[model samples]
Target: MKAVLGPFVPSYTGPWLAGVDEVGRGPLAGDVVAAAVILAPDRPIEGLNDSKQLTEKRRELLFEEIQGSAAAWCIARASVAEIDRLNILQASLLAMTRAVQGLARAPEHVLVDGNRLPQWEYSAEAVVKGDSRHPAISAASILAKVARDREMVAFDEQYPGYGFAGHKGYPTKTHLAALEKLGVTPIHRTSYAPVRERIEQIELF
Candidate 1:
């Protein structure tokens, strides 16, 4: 598939353009993680794709390679408290902005994976499905996904029985069942309907 697909082409070929992407917007728990990556024109890595399209093993492999090869990369997140306060879309944009701003080298332009660009000083374009089409965005997606997945795995160990490691805090059948039996945790976004309903149930009890 990769051979037929060939390599990803950047929308803008500027030396310092960064790609930004966020993960964990739909999950009932955990922070919204985002990543920004500035790819070195001279140092290109293979197998870049939308994180969702790649296998866990492939994503993990690319995750390491991206960090090593990219000109600049940073991972950032908006906490559950921030998510509850600002709402998911805004929180996602906030996380993306933080990721971009946290980059070791400032970006000349940013290509974001979604249609909405965060309110920031840097020049940026929101390319719908940019992850599959652009190399830097693909790298950002992989990094954000891997980082958030690892954190969810850790949270699973800390909280237990919620299946966070498996579901990654998505409102899966197992996660919903666990929420009913084990109740919400500190990492859960209370503003989400399922979590909020669970809290209400507890309050009534």
Candidate 2:
């Protein structure tokens, strides 16, 4: 993991290099939440890699450490309705922009995951596997993922049959089966394929 963090070492790079990442993009329900994290150059963290590579316990531990260590950090979300309105790509961009804008100190440079950059005024770079390569991006990934998971767990309590705690709103087979049995809920993305198909079937019936 140290080797992964080497290239992104902040040494005199600027006041900050904010790394941004989002979670819940592919979920059939729930908001897309993005996190922007600015790590202090002098105090780099160890065991920082892509969030998906870590266990849930490890991610929770890192989430606390990041909250304490970061110079500026924030998470923002675009709701399911917004995702339907803007499409996932644009909604994710909106969520990222909100996360960056919410930061107490504006970053000199923005490092984002994936190929496309957001329309923010700040100078930015998009790395294909940034969450694995960049420390700040990895940290943001953990924050966003952990935060979204917690929200899904809570939703599971409210909507008992959906199994949100298990699949976290993704289109797993169990989730698809549940949709077929229970039908659409308010939290579901009406624009998504699975939900749309179910709606059409009901309409035809």
The top-ranked prediction according to TM-score is: 1
lDDT of 1 by residue, 123-169 (tens): 88898788888889999999999999999999999999999999999
Q: At residue 87, what lDDT does model 2 achieve?
A: 98
Cα error, residue 162 of model 1, in Å, equals: 0.6
> In each prediction, how many residue pairs overlap at the backbone (N, C-alpha, C within less than 3 A)?
0, 0
lDDT at 205, model 2: 82
- Candidate 2, residues 17-57, lDDT tens digits: the string is 89999998899999999999999877777898899999999
In order of appearance, the predictions have TM-scores of 0.95, 0.93
Worst 10 residues of 2 by lDDT: 3-12
lDDT of 2 at 121: 98
TM-score of 1: 0.95
Candidate 2 displacement at residue 154 in angstroms: 0.5
Worst 10 residues of 1 by lDDT: 1-10
Tell me how far the alpha carbon of residue 122 in candidate 1 is from the true structure, in angstroms, after superposition: 0.8
Model 1's C-alpha root-mean-square deviation from the true structure amounts to 3.1
Best by lDDT: 1
